[model samples]
Target: MDIKENVKKFIQSELVTDRKFADLQDKDPLISTGIIDSLGIMRLTAFLEKSFAVRIHDEEIIAENFGTVESISALIQKKLP
Candidate 1:
């Protein structure tokens, strides 16, 4: 699957307790909407690093980078060669 789908899947399966998370749009606001919390972001950062083989720098762990599946996918794309 693509990065966006993978990200959405990760959020759905691991981060949020809400099953409706599976229906969030690609560009939906995960954090702002309370679908994922601060701890969830940390766990998601780890998942991104391991799953995508991308090193998520401290400065990169912001809303612009991890706000949505689209943003996360964009960050991963930028990290990859």
Candidate 2:
């Protein structure tokens, strides 16, 4: 699957337990909507690092990068090559 889908899947499975989130859209706000928290962001950062082999620095872990699946996908794509 694509990066957005993969990120959404990871959030749905790892950060959330609600089955409703299985269909979370790409633009959905994860942290703003409380679907995930600060700790969740850390988990997602680690996941992105391991899954996409990107090095997410401490300063880069902001809402602009991890707020939504689309943003996260863009961040990962930016890190590649």
Candidate 3:
């Protein structure tokens, strides 16, 4: 699967337990939707680093980069060669 799909799968399977929002869209607001919190952001950051082999610095972990699956995928893509 692609980056967005992989990220969505991880959030759905690991972070989000509620089945109501099972089908999380690409541009869905992760933090505002309560699907992700401060801790969840850190977890996601680590996941991005390990899964995508990208070095995510602390300063780069902003809402612009982690707000949505599409944004996160974009960040990962930007970091890649």
TM-score per candidate, in order? 0.90, 0.89, 0.93
Per-residue lDDT over 1-81 for candidate 3, one digit per residue giving the tens place of the 0 to 100 score: 999999999999889977887999999998788888887887888898999999999888888888899998999999988
lDDT per residue (tens digit) for residues 19-74 in model 1: 66668788888877797687788888899999999899999888788788888899
> Which predicted model would earn the best TM-score?
3
* Model 2 Cα lDDT, one tens digit per residue, 1-81: 888888888888898876767689989888767877877777888888999988999999887887788888999999998
TM-score comparison, 1 vs 3, better candidate: 3
Instruction: Show the lowest summed lDDT stretch of 10 residues, model 2.
Output: 14-23
Instruction: Give the winner by lDDT.
Output: 3
Q: lDDT of each structure?
A: 0.85, 0.84, 0.89
Residue 64's lDDT within candidate 3 is: 87
Off by over 4 Å in 2: none
Could you tell me the lDDT of residue 58 within candidate 1? 96
Model 1, global lDDT? 0.85
User: Which candidate order results from sorting by lDDT in descending order?
Assistant: 3, 1, 2
lDDT of 3 at 55: 98
State the TM-score for model 2: 0.89
